[model samples]
Target: MANPADGTVCNGKLHNHQKQSNGSQSGNHKRNGIIRETQQNGKPYFYNKPFVESFEKVPMYLAIFTNLSYGIGTLFGYLRDFLRKHGIEKCNMAVERKEQNDFVPLYQDFENFYTRNIYMRIRDSWNRPICSVPGPTFDVMERVSDDYNWTFKFTGRIIQDVINVGSYNYLGFAEKSDESLTTVRNVLMKYGAGVCSSRQEMGHIDKHEELENLVAQFLGVEAAMVFGMGFATNSMNIPALVGKGCLILSDELNHASIVLGARLSKATIRTFKHNNMKNLEKLLREAVIYGQPRSRRAWKKILILVEGIFSMEGSIVRLPEIIALKKKYKAYLYMDEAHSIGSLGPRGQGVVDYFGLDPCDVDVLMGTFTKSFGAAGGYIAGRKDLVDYLRVHSYGAVYATSMSAPIAEQIIRSMKCLMGLDGTTNGMQRVRQLAQNTRYFRSRLNEMGFIIYGNQDSPVVPLLLCLPSKVAAFARILLKRKIGVVVVGFPATPLVAARARFCMSSSHTREMLDTVLKEVDEIGNNLSVKYSRHKKSACPELLDETSFELED
Candidate 1:
């Protein structure tokens, strides 16, 4: 793969480039600067190869209805925009300031249009303020829009005992419980609320080191580094690992943090279909054979990026295959175990543990403490050299404020509980409980003939609702039933793939789950959302696009 070119630089080293052929230069040759090139596995324009759907089982009727909904919405939106521009109607949202009219407009017209014409109608379904801790159940502060969601006023009312399937409480550490609060309280008294400085400065404390060491031990890595922010952990450290001439092969459905990190690195990025091993292998093979674009110089590095458990689709990464591919192609691997850690595997060590794979096989192990750990901040763990390098080079380590002492203590305490080092099996019990909840919930949803996405064992469950209107209705109906849910549509997922995502937690009892199931069954019947009779496979070949259900 690192075949040297004739007089070209690859990986900061000079190599000899291939000699130009004596044949007359064609237009393509002149533009590409290659002479008499031969194809190894067909032409080098591998991306031009036919796009294959990873999961093509979306019912034909659902697809048609979804498109029709968007089509009608867009047409109305345009008509409204034209009328507003012609002074026939007033645009109540995102009014450009009189003074700022001279300057560039704050928002583009399209964004303002989407906000005003589309999102505002369903705005109440999202970002609902909660008054209680986001545990098994929470209190949602009720509000009503005065002018079609353009403005809102609190109703001076709270929806009590709303079952929470929205927050990522995972192992239920986020709940204010007695298990870790005492330790957190002690640390807060000892170190105060804020570190107030970066780790490179005066923010480094005994707790930080203690946490890092504990994290290293937990992940079975040589060392570990902690960051104050979860998103920054990916955005900042990725650039530190690869840049410029390096290549990033990312999953198309990767989280925004990974996307931002890849873009910031300035690496040549190419996405493979989500969880499609065949597509990924094709890209890797083509990349190895063709090397860099046009110049054909070897890439400085090739990094395959994936998530342990995709938050949106709720699918677990094919860790073993990905690791094998990385090894076969001599590429590096980076895994973000944000949702997987403390929620999966026999030991809750994450996807690595889930698949019974070696942790050392992954070059960069990244994760957040926010999800399962019920604490703030993130971490990167691997070899001691990698952690040492990040200590000096990572922007998060150098610039961002250090993690608060109490947060570190919380992670350390929770991690100890998880590892049974706290002299109890409470942590393991939580893991087992979470797994059981996941299986039971997913099986019930499937049995109810609801089209769901993700692995059966994953705690993050997404129930598909094809239309935007359905997304709004689903959340609203659930709220009325005293259950808080998170519904996503449009930009967050495919327009046809709007969904309500439920996060299962150990704190949730069997009664709570049964209540959710009963409510969902009634809602499904009312909204006609249970439109599938069979569970479709995620594999491309087994997909049955024509299969659909009609309500009796």
Candidate 2:
């Protein structure tokens, strides 16, 4: 046996012989031997024949390779962690898989949620645009407050002034009326400003009862009930009056509060086209079919709801047509005179008075005192029995705190003023002045090429802008010129019908109107707005129009 210099053994039988490098020596090394061989390159190399054959069985080499693999994997994992910490590795494959698994049912849930949100979609679908004017908050405030000669102050420069048509004091009763101020003072002194409890509890005050009576008397109804607020009154009263198993035939353009109230009632609700008597009649007929009389007890009552005046387009509801439909369908009529009372009719008694329709013809008459009375509260007047029923049963009136004593007193005072002994004095004078102002403003805006909507007699003069961006711009420019007007869009009105709603107040002077008109014309010209006259005819010739004919 020949041994290598490293002293390794060789297997002769399984090995093959190889030549040595010592000067042509005829020596043979075993094939499976550990030997040193000199190659042609003059390098001596060592090879282990048996060991190479069994390399897979070597534990030491396997361990070394396993360690190297693990080290590389650990380094990669650290790098991944670093990237994740810095938000560089955005997509988490594992998380994505988990999310997909979780989202399948969630997606279905979302679909169901959207289906249930139909009313929300309907309410929001009418969002429209205005103008594209822009400016800083401070700049807008300075312009509007100064131009309108209004005394305005912000609690801090950081807060912006709340600008909306609803925010303006329409009758000048908010800040200008001494009587109103005194009433509030007396109420605060006596009742401490707030009721501090719901009406059913300790909030029912004598002032509330008095105001309810006054409202009922004004509307020529037997009795009335008051609520905490206008919206609450609508939302709570409508549903409380007619809930489950009842049907509600509502105008398409009715206020959101009415819609919400009907929905909350869980009643079958059918919406007719805006002021379309035919559609209302069709719906009423269909309701009869759905609620056919299996028995006398099985038949359900129907309620037809309409606004006295549509707020968005400033259109007055055709009360006569609606009343006729109600009579035909044998349905109860509920009129929300929120925007009409104190702004329409002979003594501002609203739609019924405007049409000279008997109060008995209508089932329920609801109104708010925020606008003309310069106070905050709402009431529903109707048959004494119905009013009493609502007072005891309507959740809005029963649970909510009654109207403040001061507000009630103020409203009563205002109502008394409106119904002066001479009929053409006091609040009547204010009404006339306001109506004349509205007419003058509408005519001037029409002459200057603005598309004005609503009845000429309406206090609400909406200048159509057609785009939300344009409406915003018109508002910004007006504010820049010191005019505090409202730009209404989206959800309030359809997106395609966005407008700059100018609510003319009795407090606004002729000089103020002229200045506003001139500024509006200048702005319209600069913006290339095509000013056009409103093509709609005024109300049909009633006895009231005889004044103009007689003068002619």
Candidate 3:
């Protein structure tokens, strides 16, 4: 296979490029007679162009068996519920609140039923606790359950050196020993663990100002503000930006935090198909021309919400198209780069940089430090006026405590490293290595005929397991073999699209990936999850046919 670090396929040629220069601005550039330039960025950078591909068709036997498993489970679940209601059987989980009988139950009936029946059986596959830093390998605290995942007790067994493909430690910064940690330790000693008050009160420390400045410079924005919590960064600031009269055109599969924020804003919300630019443009046109419901009045403003890399499906957003649509419709754009920043782009600057699009084009650039930086907190970077307005109006800034000192230091250090401000090429090397690792691993999985989802460049790889039972089995079996993975089913995704998501990190070496491939190949063979009927694995070269481009 062609070296992934040599860049992706563009116009049927391998497009390798150089590192970004500090003094560079968005413009056109050419190298090796290839028009390696974007309309926004003059500097040459690798661009992973988006492509359209469908999920592998489920095999007939697998589909039947999967449906049968759920069918039998549901039948028994209802039967057991009936027996318990009739007092013929006891429900150990039932709460006996005699005095509260007149009060309404807090849980929804269907949700409660699903949790007790379907979810409980497969719960062990998720939320597995680890004792060490979430690097390529970590120590998971072993546990035992007496009631089939309803309750658990520690087994006092530590599974050491388990390969972790579950975490969002993309750049491998989530490690115990690193220069970032040194900076964090120094800050902790100087400033203590946290600021006890809100930024509006006494919580605004020098670290906050420094971090915000660094963040603005890093993101190429006029200004930026930090929040103590990642979720709150979206859930709080979005409301402050738009309110009741405004409209939010959101991606259907947006993160829960975005959904919560939109709901809290009390804005008129509409969803379009995931990454469908045509649908997005249609919505934008409708919002602009048709106006608000009932009153038929023009809405105050419209905000299009999307993510850099979708967390579950492993899809990268169609950014250039979205930007074009945003400009065409005159609507504001809010991009959540929770999973993208520090993991993408030649410079690790997220999707905007990946596409060589001007950061200013995105009305709001929001991201968290948790994933790539291996730190806590989030930030919103944009025009000075917008950030200034948010500082006073956003609940996270006015009411919530400022980012912790050590966390701010961690972000500062990592951001510097990613931007090559640390006077070392280590950051760029990590970026290239991560790209290489992601492509190589993805190619191998495709070769194994294990159906995978999302863009080929995305670090998040979701291998289709198809059945909830298979999801559980895949995770449990992997864990037993000293590999840590995360599986999702039901509420997190469509019930039928059950999958095990493997997050790639720069920390993962080729040997580690090969080990995972060998074990997964064996397990897949056993579970019959290799449903792809494609002939590409045998041919090998077809895997590199995915697209990459620079929009002029």
Query: What TM-score would candidate 1 get against the native?
Result: 0.86
Q: Which is better, 1 or 3, measured by lDDT?
A: 3
Could you tell me how far off, in angstroms, the CA of residue 270 lies in candidate 2 after the best superposition?
Answer: 0.8
Q: How accurate is candidate 2 locally (lDDT)?
A: 0.61
Model 2: per-residue lDDT, tens digit, 1-552? 213321212232211112242333233222112121222222112111121000011133433544454456447656755675477975232223345774544334323322222222222221222221111111222211321221233333321332323232445454544544675677778877677787778888787777776777677667788776899888998877887778888888898889999999888788888766678888887776657434433336899989987777677776666777777778899999888888776566787655445566789888888877777878888888998788678888667777767777778777877767324466766666666666677667666666666655667777766543356567666655555566665446654455677776666667777777888889888864533432222222211433212100
Residue-by-residue lDDT tens digits, candidate 1, 289-376: 9999989999989999999999988888877678878878999999999999998776788886665455778999999999999889
Query: How do the residues 94-212 of candidate 3 rate in per-residue lDDT, one tens digit apiece?
Result: 66477876789654555577678888878887676889999999999998898788789998989999998989999998888854488789889999997999999999999999999
Higher-TM-score candidate of 1 and 3: 3
- lDDT, residue 327, candidate 1: 78
TM-scores for all predictions: 0.86, 0.68, 0.90
Of candidates 2 and 1, the better by TM-score = 1
RMSD of each: 13.2, 38.8, 5.6
- In Å, residue 505's CA in model 1 sits off its true spot by 0.4
Candidate 3's TM-score reads 0.90
TM-score ranking, best first:
3, 1, 2
Candidate that scores best on TM-score:
3
- Kindly report which residue stretches of model 1 are placed more than 4 angstroms away from their true locations once superposed: 1-56, 98-103, 535-552
> What CA RMSD would candidate 2 show?
38.8
Which lDDT value does model 3 have at 548? 21
Candidate 3 has its poorest 10 consecutive residues by lDDT at 1-10
